[model samples]
Target: MAPGSSAFKEVVESHPKQMNHKTLKMKAESGTVKTSMSLAEKHSIHGVHELLQCPTCAGSMYPPIHQCPNGHTLCANCKIVHKCCPTCRFELGNIRCLALEKVAESMELPCRYQSLGCQDLFPYYDKAKHEKHCPFRPYTCPYASSECCVTGDIPFLVAHLKEDHSVDMHDGCTFNHRYVKSNPHEVENATWMLTVFNCFGRQFCLHFEAFLLGTAPAYMAFVRFMGEDSDARKFNYTLEVGAFGRKLMWQGVPRSIRDSHRKVRDSQDGLIIPRNLALYFSAGSGQELKLRVTGRIWKV
Candidate 1:
């Protein structure tokens, strides 16, 4: 292979192969070589790939690649936040690198999440869509009794919840729980309990919390499935709280843990009781709250 431009020379040195590439040459009327390439080598592919990277962010460049008068190039997004070329400090203008864009159109690349277990390859244009719905994407920890930021696959998260969060683990679809508070007025906007149930070869989380619903202090309880939204739709749960023949019931489908606990709580999709009603159900001291909550889960 013969030496071309500075970038082409680097490509030749890196990839030394003997394969004929498609002819990519151009000539102007004045006999001045606008573009010349005799890419009869295999080593130039990686060098061309490096040329598509934005010098500023080091990310792959797509369409509308901009350049400065000095020939320094950057992606369109970097061009917005910068007034001059990052390499040569030359004032930037609306100069598009059409040649590089054409090269990118001919290449295919792997997903950025390839290290995260996504073994898929796509054209430069189709990479983003595949990553959005990738099954191998990590899920956030569903433990809602605290501010936790752990994320991993489902099995790792289940183990983490039991060890790090000290969450209760049960083994049945039906459950009965009793919540007792000496000072109901002192309850703040916080989660009180989170229990996990292993049922039907899957897992579910039960959440109980106390928060201010508008100006009134209230209690809420709900269940969430430890899976995706589509699988969550295959089950239903009901919660009941009552005393002295008076009861409150809430029936709904379980939301997937994909929705954060705060999101589900803010939507108020659960059994809710005002402070006064809860105290009446306690049937004890005026300053005490002893509420019993029972729930059952089944496939629909």
Candidate 2:
């Protein structure tokens, strides 16, 4: 081999690993290391989302992310319960993963309820807040009976209530019904009836229940719009019950079923009748209950 070529070859062979490492060190120190960390990259969003997921809970990591001595990180909620790194079993420390937190601040993500028909993108910081109030969030079954665990979007829940729960469905804004019971005095904290009424291309739930209003046994009747609260505000309803020339009426806005039936009932924002008054309106002996309820719903 030529003299110069042979000398160069010997130098390269003597410390090849060290020379390559020194070059990499220089690139890193100068902030010129070629990396796929740019946000402009096509896969960067997905990669960042994956990176921010807590190893322990698989949830997106928020602020105060804690790290173990070996650089493994977990979310704040998991940190409180975990004594070691979930990823590497390394002993955890009080160190916060500030780098990861800063990275999250620079990102944007689609709503977690995108599959539920929410077509909105939010910055990482505002994502949780938007998701909390997202209209497309799944709704629990509105069946007055507390036995149903079903939850889904409006159409799915509507079908579920009809087919699975066998709930009555009506097609009018005005309704009149007679509720009869064998024992008017045997009042308990239980749901009595739930009727679905479709009007103005929307659905409403008329809920009736017997519960203790403070210390007195009372019966409550109310209506709930099966849509978002904002849309529910566009409508109002009136309920009236009468007998023996005496009548009781309540007029108010229909609450959104987004508020659970129990929640609305407990709020007592509906027409409530005391057990004694209800029996007085009955057609027969005080032991039997036969009360008539008439209501109308209108767009406001």
Q: Best by TM-score, which number?
A: 2
* lDDT (CA) per prediction: 0.75, 0.75
- Taking every candidate in turn, the Cα RMSD to the unseen true structure, in Å, is 19.0, 25.2
lDDT of candidate 1 over 11-121, digit per residue (tens): 001112223422221111121122233444224645777898899999878889999988899999999999989999989999999988987877555555556665545
Worst 10 contiguous positions by lDDT, candidate 2: 7-16
In model 2, what lDDT does residue 218 have?
90
- Candidate 1 CA-lDDT value: 0.75
After superposition, candidate 1 runs with Cα above 4 Å error = 1-52, 105-107, 113-117, 145-147
- Write the residue-wise lDDT of candidate 2 on 239-274 in tens digits: 888888899999999998889888998998899988
Q: For each candidate, what TM-score against the reference?
A: 0.78, 0.82
* C-alpha lDDT (0 to 100) for residue 215 of candidate 1: 82
